[model samples]
Target chain A: MKRFLVVGSRDLTEYVNGKYVPLVVEELRAKGHDVTLFLIENGVIAARDGSKAGKVLNGLSDKGARVYAEDVSCRARGVQTLASGISFSNLDFLADSIAEGFDNIVWY
Target chain B: MGKTEPPGSKKKKTQKVAIILSTGSYQREAPTTVLRLAEKLLERDIEVNVFAFEEAVTLTNRDQIEHNEPPSLRKVLGDRHVYVGKFVDQLLRVGLHGAKMDWVTCVLCAQERGVENHQIGGSIVGTLGDLWKFVRGADHVIAIPTYR
Candidate 1:
């Protein structure tokens, strides 16, 4: 399966553009591609437990897509707790991922 | 002894990242985020190429000044507010000692914003061709749009 690293920097509050990340992730998962959703900056808001965006992420997680929220971004926004299946990551991981090579890298 | 290849005959296979930044500073956090990411990438010795277009061209304006906060808001705003240009300059300086970084400001965009002649010392005034060159050479690409 082709590997994908999708980075989202916007939060759900910006509904118009924010929705595309989840939508695209869902489609990629449906096609059985390996996908990693990396939420950074304000995008970490989607990892907060009990939020609508969190629910969507949870659903995506259940579908087998790996979801991660940047640790610094989460702390900056005071998002201490995360939804189930979402893990905390750092820019090091991002850099390493890019170094390791991905079939596709998408940024939002 | 093995035959020596000509100097500079082969290009180094260094990992490179291209960041397309279309957003300006102060109004949003995207430029700050781009700077942070660029620093982190450089720490890993990844070459960074930043293609700044639209309002992002204003980020490299050398005329940026940090003024003291107004007396009324000084308590919360601190004595002086740091400008994004300072950070950009610092990053460029740091990159000089380690992994290289090219901060290219679109010529058309800079002219539109009247920052063509005011760009920081290290930043290059480039055409759209330079943007495509960065994209073509980079192993990874990150685009920070103007909207968000």
Candidate 2:
């Protein structure tokens, strides 16, 4: 049960529409590993309230997965705030990820 | 900073900064992280490269498959960047074609997507070795994984 970061950036539907994220996170957590998410740029956009990605993200959050975004990336892309799913983070989170020795998983 | 420097230098120090687009759907805007990071690295005169392989190669297709973000990855890769795409044509359908990755060594990904060694895109059938080299040579390898 190691900590892992599953980056969900592109396809909102898979997780948002299809519930892929909830299923995977549920299974991973069921297995006893801590799971988190870092949605950035367009990824962060998915987090917007009322967005499909947002709904999906909300579901994952309900299940105990901590979610975040790269603040710097968000700023560069003009994303002022992250939506329903999670909070925004500074690049320091990237360091936190490395410091904590979390495995990175990807979802586009 | 010979791989022993403190990690906090990320903001102050420059990095070689090469990223593997992998081209899979998982990358999304993050895949462009390669381009974003590359631009930053290039500002400091560091080198940046985009390597594509595996099902990741499927990324080049810009057809806007249902329920995706706007400005497909190909649109993002267009801004003065260098990337290698296996099944490069698949990416081209999305309007991505600058430097096809021919200079690097290619090996068969255990799953094998290309046809007779080639997939729909006339890509140089590739493998994990290609990925390993990118990881070994570059400062860091960020994978933008996609799921169907």
Evaluated with DockQ, which candidate comes out highest? 1
Stretches of candidate 2 above 4 Å error? A14-18, A72-81, B1-19, B23-31, B35-130, B133-141, B146-148
- Against the true structure, whose lDDT is highest? 1
State the fnat of candidate 1 relative to the true structure. 0.27
User: Which tens-of-lDDT digit does each residue in A16-61 have in candidate 1?
Assistant: 8777788899999999888889899889998998888898999999
Q: Note the Cα lDDT for every prediction shown.
A: 0.84, 0.51
Candidate 2 versus truth, CA RMSD in Å, comes to: 10.2
Count clashes in each candidate, considering only residues at least 3 apart in sequence or on different chains. 0, 14
Clashes of 1: 0
User: Once superposed on the true structure, which residue ranges of model 1 sit more than 4 Å away at CA?
Assistant: B1-14, B71-77
Q: Give the TM-score of candidate 1.
A: 0.89
lDDT of 2 at B17: 35
lDDT of 1 by residue, B38-59 (tens): 8887888889999998999989
Q: Can you write out model 2's per-residue Cα lDDT over A5-81, one digit (the tens) per residue?
A: 67656535545543565577767877887787766655666666556667777877877777776676667666665
Displacement of the residue A50 alpha carbon in candidate 2, Å: 3.3
